[model samples]
Target: MSEETPVLSLPLIQPSQAQKHVTHNEALMRLDALVQAVVLTRDSISPPSDPDAGECHIVPSAATGVWSGQDHALAYFDGTAWQFLAARPGWRVYVLSDLQTVFWDGSAWTGETASFQNLNGVGIGTNSDSTNRLAVSSEASLLSHDGAGHQLKINKSAAADTASLLFQTGWSGRAEMGTAGDDAFAIKVSADGAAWHTALSFDPGTGLATGDAVQTSATDTSAGRLMRADFGYGPGNVLGAVSESAGVPTGAVIERASTVNGDYIRFADGTQICQFNASLSYISAGLCSAVWTFPAGFVSGSTPQVQGTLNSDSLAASAPSVTVAGLTGMTISGLGATSVTLNVNALASASFGSGESVDLGVLAIGRWY
Candidate 1:
């Protein structure tokens, strides 16, 4: 048998030897230093001069006085002098100064949490709650990266389920920015923690955003809102029929009517332009007139501007090369909201065109309201 223990190396009492009680007492003194050890400190370089009995310390490197040469060993005062036991791997002690348990992990003393895996419901500086699972009460917390980068992600179970980060003041919710109440990302705010306002939200597919604080219609002049584009347009929107009372656009940007008699084009700014065609006979010599009724009337009280040009059918080398277009004067008369009369003065010479196909293209501009 060995003279000392194989584990703790406690001195064994010699067989049939005198002073066996001294060896047994030495072993008991080593036991008193270990076994649920509570160390004063692990930074002591020397033994204390007035240490109490059974007081233990971890002797550091290059220990001075009575602890000289006993580096990294557990030292305890045994009433007369100090006793030491060499430290080993897996040796544990509760440090009074740090108020934590440390263990010698074959290389150095490390905190009990130096290596841990798969621990859940672990609270730091607070208690973990049922729903929270891992609650923390602190002024601030840090989650640093191991080498290059870090990402904090919150996932949800379904599209309708909420996955969000809520900010609170005095246990009352104040603001939040995350995918809340749905898969879309949203930012919501609350003044009294009871009523909430969705300040912004984004679509998952199109990445478009919509909110009450955003300017929707193109003509919206409200302040304190972000300018935004409408999600839908065309005939259902700015291209639709004119409706001044509609809150979207004041009226259609542009509207057109293709009629057999009169073709008209209307603009949003209340301007309407219409066209008409006329074929007059030159058999009536001096002043011939034709009245054209507009396909659409202008806003009453507004007289439309009328102008026309004659595209003569037969220009068989007429006299007076200066008036080659057959007619001397074309003027507008009796202008009104819905119709106007075009007067033409035929040439005095008998160079009358035989056909009534004296086509005249006329245009009128006025307000359509």
Candidate 2:
């Protein structure tokens, strides 16, 4: 047996690509006479578990061919058969149960999906819609919660490079400042910390021209303060400074005065704006932000009075009770007898008859018509 070394013979290893099993002698003799005259189709094609007959839920060598129950369930895998692996490699886990649809690689679980009923439940923000549901957090700013709290915040980072959005009606709170033309704004307003009301301001007079906004409507809220400030400047001429926080009231002031009701302030082409002063009560920078509206039948006196006399003689009834400050509501026409009209509490005395009372003091009033 020492010289029998010539019995060494090895040559049998094929399969580069030879998989051609074509058997159809009339479809395998009509499937072997219909599987031997069928007994429930030969026990339903037998093999449900039979790793070479050792059986034990066999179907794992990865999965050995020809065992179709519509093609494997539970552990999935059903592409129309042909799978065999008998285990031994990464704990085999094939799941293809009609893999409805899938796809996602932002991190993990990506069989590429779009169906499978939207394969939910598994990782990375799961799936969100409303603008990505606030996207992401960790102090990069912008946060919100509606389950009842978290309020609201949006400050990716800003202390004063420009930050604002305050709107509260009745209790007072309004700040509006946003410009991109001519550019110049400095407005202020506040309450508790002890008065601050630098209300309306806008400056951008020159060529780049586009800056004009000043709005305030504080129709008495008893005492609780009001606020509204705006400031923006960047068009070259740059000269903007109007600062006051609380109820607002610091230095340079003249925030509002544009009386228009039969408007008046005439100097035509010279820059002193305001017009329509019928009886003239406008004493420039003197006092009287706005007042002058009398044309009805003014004969109602007392804190809300209006009396008119002196129909002609160039107008001069000369102060009697002298209280008629501005006529906006009471309209008094020429009273009978011989000229007797007086409206104070806002003073209104037009004259002509002087009917000889001589006291230049009027007190004969009584006309409801």
Candidate 3:
């Protein structure tokens, strides 16, 4: 105080303010006092307690905590009141406060009675060996686990009929409706229950009626479970029109399509068997000049068997007459002789003789598919 200045000689400072030099000196002295009193305060401060030595009441779980004891010897305060947490090993109990206890029957903590007092949802239990588990409540759902996946049951109510189970197997069967007295048919198949391939197709009006057994192929029989069945009508408005053609090709009848002259006959088979040209001048009268014998043992059916052309031996012929053969498989059963002649229309005056020559044309055959 003797070395300091007078209180009235200071510059205009606030009433609650102190001088900077005085404040600095006061802080230094306090620091020095504190350093000098550290030894005395050392005895006053006790050593820090060990953190991991007691029955931990509020321990944060790094892993699961195992509670095992026989008689009620331990107590814990769960931020509220002191209560006994567990008792003995085969006989266990947890005092969860307010006269409530959680009892365990060698397995899990269960209520003495089904008390809905603090129950949030439902209760679950396991069998004696704990291999199977069951859950109980007023309205219960199911859950199954096989260490691979988990499934849950959901209760739903609707006016419409919906899909109950959506399980995918190797195969599925379906019955598609058609016209009354129509046949049932198989439509498609699937391998993994997604992509489908058509297995069988039926013609319109070719389906089996209701209650009829559907016939399957050897391929379908072997691939039993991995197959599927469906039914549909034929394309367009036609019903069951499935008709399979013969496996073999059959010969059809040929009709006359074109002609060069009336004398020459052309058939639809594309075979130009005969020709009518302005050659071999004959008498200008259309007549059978001479009587020639007709061939014996000639028969006709669906097809022509023996084809022959009669050369007008009586006169020079102008046009060649054509005859188609019969069915190839048919045999000439009873023939009178090898040389059978027929009547011809030609120049009978002086240019020709009787029964000169005859020729057979290309023979046609029948084929079956």
Best prediction by lDDT: 1
RMSD (Cα, Å) of model 2: 21.8
Off by over 4 Å in 3: 1-72, 77-301, 304-369
Residue 30, model 3: Cα distance from true site in angstroms: 46
Q: For each candidate in the order shown, give its overall lDDT on alpha carbons.
A: 0.76, 0.29, 0.29
Candidate 3 C-alpha lDDT tens digits along 1-369: 333224212223334665866555544433332222111111112212322222222111131222222122233322233323332333323332323344435444444565566443343542222321333434556567888898554334532323232323533532222222223233544456656544444444655322213324212344233322322122331222122233211122222222332122222232322222211222223222222122211123222232333333422232333111211111222222221222223233312232332222222222211
TM-score of 3: 0.19
Native-referenced Cα lDDT, model 3: 0.29
Residues 192-271, candidate 2: write the lDDT tens digits. 42353444445557322221223233223333333223322233213222223443422122211234332222111111
- Better candidate by lDDT, 1 or 3: 1
Best by TM-score: 1
- Candidate 1 residue-wise lDDT, 1-369, digit = tens: 789998889998877979988999998888877888999988878677799999998877788998899877888888888888888899999999889999888767887985457556778888887687778889998999999999998888887788888999999999988886677889899998999988889998999888767777777667787865442235555664554444344646777886766788877768889997775444354545678888888989998888887665433332122244456657877888988877766666534443333457888999887
Every model's TM-score: 0.61, 0.18, 0.19
Report the lDDT of model 3 for residue 307.
Answer: 35
After superposition, the stretches of candidate 2 with alpha carbons farther than 4 Å from their true spots are: 1-148, 156-158, 165-369
